[model samples]
Target chain A: MTSSAMQQLYQQIILDHAKSANGAVAELAALDADAATAASAAGVRLAQSHQVNTTCGDEITVRVGLSGTGADARIDEFAWRGAGCSISMASASVLNDTVRGTTVAESEAMLDLFREMLRSRGTIEPDEEVLGDAAAFAGVSKYPARVKCAMLPWVAFEAALLQLAEPA
Target chain B: MTFVAPPPAPARDPSDQTPSDHAQTDQPLTDRSGSDLTLSSDEVLRIRNDFPVLHQLVNGHPLAYLDSGATSQNPISVMEAEQEYYEQRNAAVHRGAHTLAFAATEVFEAARATVAAFVGAAENEIVWTSNATEGVNLVSYAFSNASLGLGGPAATRFRLGTGDEIVVTEMEHHSNLIPWQQLALRTGATLRFIPVRADGTLDMTAAGEILNPRTRLLAVTHASNVVGTINPIDDLVAMAHAVDALVFLDACQSAPHLALDLTALGVDFAVFSGHKMLGPTGIGVLYGKAELLAAMPPFLTGGSMITTVDMQGAEFLAPPQRFEAGTQRISQAIALASAVDYLSHTGMHRIRTREAELGRRLVEGVTAIPGVRLLGPGLGVERIGLAAVDVAGVHAHDVGQFLDEAGIAVRVGHHCAQPLHKKLGVTASTRASTYLYTTDDEVDRFLAVLAEVAPFFGVSR
Candidate 1:
């Protein structure tokens, strides 16, 4: 008999996302190269951060592109490529989809909300209306070891954002 | 607490006793023949009672531990030995005129002698280090010291420059590989490795081509921690010696399961961790040839290791003392000696035979499951009672989680051998390893849990 904890941790949605992955491997590689080039060009700001969970060798390179300036600054794209467990991969896929078109401030707010939920240890009920597809990861909070897996992509996203905010 | 003596031996005709029971008599345990080594199923069940940690419930089911490759659980006797040392003879060894110090030094030196005998080395040949990582680093740093012209004429043989090469195997854990890599980088020497074959064994053809006269040293693992493939060390040692290159063996995985004899193996240096051998952590053994250790420069300096100092230059002691700096893990060393005693009493041949049977069962059982790929030597090959496997579509971490939910514990990921995993065409793998205390039921539970992993993740065909 499977415990409710195990069922919650490996939800059907997380499994489905991990299987499909959504982004093509070749396309992700191409986007990585394109992001690197754009980050070096004038007037187009891009930030890329590679995060690794040394414990299990789970890794991700997240690239966030920003267009426009100041309050009007918008997240043009969020792209990532890596290999990990279902929770980590699903969390990355959901993070890319949720933060693609939001403004800089809105993306920061989402990151903060996700971090808070993960730190709750299953106590904070996930707000699906706010987290969208990412809300399925609430079960991950119950496991301390899996928390790093769910946060790998988001931590990379935050690092990229911080790089974008730094003055040249 | 009242102490209870073991029941008296039953009176019977000497010829009627089985060889397994005879092993417990006055004869040397190592003298038992190969046919006498195999344990009955009932013996394995009885052996499990010695390890208290094995009796527990994890999650909601009986705990099945299959991660002994990482660290084996200690039996009660080993723990008691350490606690007794702390309670009675706790004092700084090799210092002072007090009775406690003399007693402590006696116990410490006794441990060194026991560990030396365990691996077939002289007491002076064994050097204490914090762990296996430090043991490897000690030798690597000696090479660096020789490169800087630290030890006199005797150390010149170890010196390397731009053209020299250090050869290692792809199967080495990072502990063995990274030190050589850094040494190469620091000394302008090239770092090379013998490629691993598809079966996870070393490629001797590549080894022949790589181990030329320019090769200053060759380091390899006796058995791989990831794939569980025991390398052909005799041939490799011969190849290294033919080129006048020194050889070092990483015995971390093999020391716990195999009967080790460093002198017989003909390696210049070897290292193994205590924690992995059912002993306490923070203590490890490094065995070097007597002459080589006497000539090599020290890695760490200060305290008891030195002979005299006047702020200009200092003379260091010989061999073991020169290498061991600062206060050592005295209690851990005692515990490790007790662990060695336990293993010796059980007879290494018997333990090895039992583990081989368990390993065969694990390999056969896990491979029988659908969508499972075994990474090491095939079913019939002789290995060190361990298996690393990759599922068809499920990541290793996911498989590990699924197994954990079923109360099975295993090591998942590259297992500190990322290069070997890449060579095997896998990002990671789940490994199930066995020690003497492991039972057939635990091995079966591990396989049963693994059978559910693919289906649980909806990846089954």
Candidate 2:
């Protein structure tokens, strides 16, 4: 197939997300408190946010926080920014809602799960209990570049967890 | 996006007469096409056949070339000029005393004469460089060397130091921009730009403010690759001259498409790549005023460019030879001269006229398709033979992909003018450019293929 056939993938959902990618900023204080709470129960805190969708410039921010002993992470805030296709933003939005307040080890494990689920490389569905909002992005794995968009929030969540694990 | 193979270049039967033998076939010609747009089909075909690459296919598809802004297809005559040199009298020019060397040297110098004639400059003013990029870097690096106080008395003209300014346009390709930026950084000078207006024209009003007494040099593109806007160079040159600043022209986009006479333009230095002008890659021309080039120190030293050499030091060769230090792209240079001959034969004025007509047709056709917003000037006076457009709601990548599927090739993204792209309020754009080989049928087919873009992307009708 010629490079042009790749054009078929620019679905309407993508355009909508590109046209209106609001709600990028989030309340940092509230999300921070959630991180503190998650850390108390687990050894570390975790937060995730989507940065930018590389494909069409769509970006979402997901912040993960760990409250207690840095064992677990709690979803503090999920915000989106930029303009891009719908699948990426929708996927990030969904992923943010699903993985809040998970343990550090569990969050680490869930990263692979999320990646696999987003890619559809594995026959597993996202853990419904954990992947709540992120389920919309499960089909996004079909497009390789979009996977980065879907994974951005998750990566941010992991970063927040790592930050909590560091000695203050 | 899929990239179909570009058509295979037609095999040339070496028995054909060499280009030089037929160089005068279309001489005594001027800009007239000898027929109307639709009124002269034979004339158009004649012009088309002059470009050898157009006769081939890419991946079983006839090449629908729209990438002239990137590079143009060379004519057979250009190829023959390069090949015939090696086949007939191959020798190291100007370095050997034998007949072969003399003959080779004659052709080499004559090629320089041809180029000087083409650009409306004296033969002494034309300095051969690897390509336009090298030419820009040559000027930039020379300035840097001068700033270090190492170039002797000739260095005074380039002594840019603290509080000095080097002006460039925002529309410059990275090649023209970066070297100046680096030069400024090294010399404590300021790097400034003439801002682009909303209509894709240079903001001359802003340029007036930028070119003050502190300005030392001004570099600008003759034509924009992405938006296809020919710059207001007269105003820019005048502005820079007012401040005693030397002006450099990046003619990569304009030289092939327009009739350029560097002397008339009054720029201190002008640079263009051969590939973009229907010659082979790996060669370019840098034309500098004889006095200025003579004053500028050599950027590279050793080999062919040197004169009398002592154990402690060495004197350099004259102007052009001083700049071209190494063995040059001899064959490529020969081919480029031939390409110039081909353009001259077709009458650059006629080519430019035809392209202008096509630009008008392209603008009309592309605009008529709903949801396509053409960027830059809509008319010939402000625009050139290219069009950049945004298909409503569709990403540029997707647009390129769709076009590629239909055997149409166009450039996407910032086209290496990121600042201009940002100024235009677009992350990227889909650009369709044309040259001599572009035809009315190709334009019509392109428009037809583009009409399918919105529907294929499911963009709102």
Candidate 3:
């Protein structure tokens, strides 16, 4: 007796992504967590951002590294480790796959679109051309509480990038 | 309904009354909480009808609100009481010269007297704060003021310093815990807590060691907002009093569900929020013993609380007024009195009896569901009508969303008790708390839905 909205919100695609995210935890743990603070002589650096949804106690930490500087900068390493609901974890997993090879500017644009889609309140159909698997979260916008759960990872991604942009 | 003010309760014990007497001689300190007068299923349905919001549908199914622990839904009478006041008797009280003003002040005092009588305190002993959080902060800051040499010689007992200790329990909501922690930080006193066992009951053996001579204040919840463990307040009050320490009960969870005779409870100070008890949001009550409130300095000082004013200084009014220092929550207070009337007319002991049955049902049902772990004391132990549980492999947020889709509204999170959740080895939990209006069928629906939770998440349990 699940409603259409609930099915749309927790689709098979999202559940699959969440299962993969749990599997990726061991791989994510192997990354140099300390690299977030220590930058080498290379112009690019690894940055990490830890975010929590205080309302529900969901927590996620995103770690990302860049391959170069300026316009040519490409996302080299993207990994996350956290404990939360399916929506948040699936979102992190989807974002990790979608943004890993894209340039930094493209990732930022994708994040902005994802955020706007979540705030659309079920009016704006998610542009899957940009969001990829992240588009599965379009139904989440109808629920103001769950929208935060969906956006948690992308916000962390932006924060990690912002940290990398800062003069190290 | 026209409200009548009850006579003020006399504080019978002397200021130096012995701790053992407060604990032992008052009555048998055993479990007097279990009342045999249970509400019938049809009577509960009638009670449910009184709450207009309970008859609604959400997500194409009937709404079953199990989040009364967060905020109880108001009955029709409580809502109408606030509306009637605004429509007919709206005026600024305690300062106006008009006829409406006089009327408003009279009704406002009547509300105070009603709430005071409900909690077994003198009318002058209750001070209105915005919420229970503000009430705790008010006392903490008043202690800070006293430590800084305010309230003159009468306030000397309120001071805390390097050697003083402020004790609290491990299960307190952050509203109760953080204020004391900050007060300790401000006054350089040591902050200690009596730990909770795996069963969610307070470790009384450890409690014996924690409450000692240096303990200046012992703040604990009358009942846990999370796990629904009703603390042994009589024994705790006795132990704290034995050390000559002040006791403050956070009755936010208890006052709404229990028959609270705060005088008989023997705590020095206590607080409960009005909204959780079916009143409006902007009003809360802080109950203190008459002498302690008389000696304490004001927390918020302004016009309504003053007696005389000069350019340099002003003399403060007594007790409640000294603490109430603004235009105040007038209609909210009236609405709260109406809520008190509703509860009193309904009978607090009957409500208690009904909730105990509901609590047992919740515990039994959830515990029977494989992979669901109940937080508080189990079957054969007494608790209020609530249960918080951790479902194996499914996150609480997901559980909440699933329940929402089923039109079963519940509270999901650490429930403002992160430390206790941490001690229980979880970041969040799903809590289903009931009130008098909650039906037996609704409890069954919750259990049925909860059984589907782990399986829906594809977890094998």
Identify the leading candidate in terms of DockQ: 3
Which stretches of candidate 3 lie above 4 Å from their native place?
A22-44, A127-130, A166-168, B1-36
Report, for candidate 1, the interface RMSD: 1.3
Better of 2 and 3 by lDDT: 3
Which stretches of candidate 2 lie above 4 Å from their native place? A1-168, B1-33, B36-40, B50-52, B55-61, B86-90
Q: CA shift at A24, candidate 1, in angstroms?
A: 5.4
Predicted candidate 1 versus true structure: per-residue lDDT over B1-461, tens digit per residue: 33232222212244653333432355553444324666666655555665778889988788888999999998766776788778878899999887788878888888899899999999999999989999999999999998999999999988999999999999899999999999999999999999999989889999999999999999999999987877889999999999999999999998899898989999999999999998989999999999999999998988989998888999999989999989989999988998887787777778888888988998899789989999978777888878999999899998888888888899999999999999999989999999987878889989887888888889875
Model 1 bad stretches (over 4 Å):
A23-44, A166-168, B1-35
Candidate 2 residue-wise lDDT, B274-317, digit = tens: 99988889999999999999888878888898889989999888
Interface RMSD of 3: 1.2
Residue pairs in clash, model 1? none
Interface RMSD for all numbered candidates: 1.3, 4.9, 1.2
lDDT of each: 0.86, 0.73, 0.87
> In model 2, how well does chain A match by TM-score?
0.55
Residues B1-461, model 3: lDDT tens digits: 44343222211233534221211123321223243376667566756766778888988789999999999988766776778778777899998787778778987998899999999999998999999999999999999999999999999989999999999999999999999999999999999999999999999999999999999999999999888988999999999999999999999999999899899989999999999998889999999999999999999998799999999999999989999998989989988988887777667888888899999999999999999999988998889999999999889999999998899999999999999999888999999999988988899999998998887778866
DockQ of each model vs. true complex: 0.63, 0.19, 0.72
Q: After superposition, how far is residue A165 of candidate 1 from its true place, in Å?
A: 1.9
Looking at model 1 chain B, which ten-residue stretch has the lowest summed lDDT? Answer: B3-12
Best by TM-score: 1
> Could you give candidate 2's per-residue lDDT for residues A145-165 as a string of tens digits?
556755665666555556556
